[model samples]
Target: MKDFLPVLKILLRFVIVYIVLVLLYQFYLNEYENDVVDPFTRWVAQQVAFLQSIFGFPTVLVDSLKLHSILFQTEGRFTTRMVEGCNVISVVILFSAFVFAFYKGAKTFLYVLAGLVILHILNVLRIVMLNIIFIKYPQYERVGHDYIFPAIVYGGVVVLWLIWIQFFALKKTDKS
Candidate 1:
């Protein structure tokens, strides 16, 4: 029990930081709903528009999902909402905190930071792909959005965690 004190302290710090960050995020989301959400949504929508333009997919912007404008192009409809579902910031922060708590030294820190950046890029690409999928096959949107994209995001996190454990944590244990 005495030997585990350091580990427990690190974990507790991680949890506190995580909670604080999450609360701040929530507060920001609530306080600046339109200012934050709209810009983000617009940016994502614009990116989708650009991608669709390149790919020659038909695209349209409706007031909601109800109205119709055109077809094929990616929709930016849900980009500016309450930041629920597929928000990458939370995941990135959590993964970063986890790595920082468990790992030691600059090399491990750099690797974890790099991994986090890559994960976020992949997540953005995932969003783009999901938008395309939603546009191309409207029927599959539910499955793609709810399940498939989440698996990709969370799975990436899990893989990163495993790598950290295997390379840094477990290796150190084995050496000592």
Candidate 2:
């Protein structure tokens, strides 16, 4: 019983944070009129188009509130609609929950903030890359979007967690 107490505490923290975030997200989604998620989706689409422009791909970002995503059209050829999933909010919540669960100190908060920013940037890059790849090789769209891109972003989060544990979390444990 004693041995499981620490694990239970960590799980309780994680669950509480996760539940709160999920509820907040749900509330945001339920705001159908003058929805907040649309603007975020638009921002992501705009950012993605900007990234595509840097590579000289001639991109267009179409804002469609009804569609609930930003339509990314490149050279009037290939189009990739970036929805809420592409925004990285869910991943942010998951990462935050885990960090809160194993939180050590102010350092941990800083790490979580940095990680969220990095993850958001990576997600944007992933969308841009996927659109480019889809335009160039339409056949590989499913594999790139479904597997390769997620592997990279999620794999990055896993690496960040490992670094936190090794450099920060463990030090606190050792000291205590």
Highest lDDT: give the candidate number.
2
Give per-residue CA lDDT, model 1, range 64-103, as digits (tens).
3322111223344432122333447778778877877775
Which clashing pairs does model 2 show?
A: none
Q: For residues 1-176, what per-residue lDDT tens digits would candidate 2 score against the true structure? A: 99999999999999999999999987876775455245566677788899899998889876667876667878886478877878888988898898889878798789999998898899889988898888888899999989999987898789888887788766655446
Q: Assess candidate 1 and give its TM-score to the true structure.
A: 0.71
The candidate that achieves the highest TM-score relative to the unseen native structure = 2
How accurate locally, in lDDT, is each candidate? 0.64, 0.83
- Those runs of model 2 whose alpha carbons end farther than 4 Å from true positions after fitting are 32-37, 172-176
Per-residue lDDT value at 141 in model 2 = 90
Per-model TM-score versus the true fold: 0.71, 0.91
Per-residue lDDT value at 79 in model 1: 28
Error of 2 at 126 (Å): 0.4
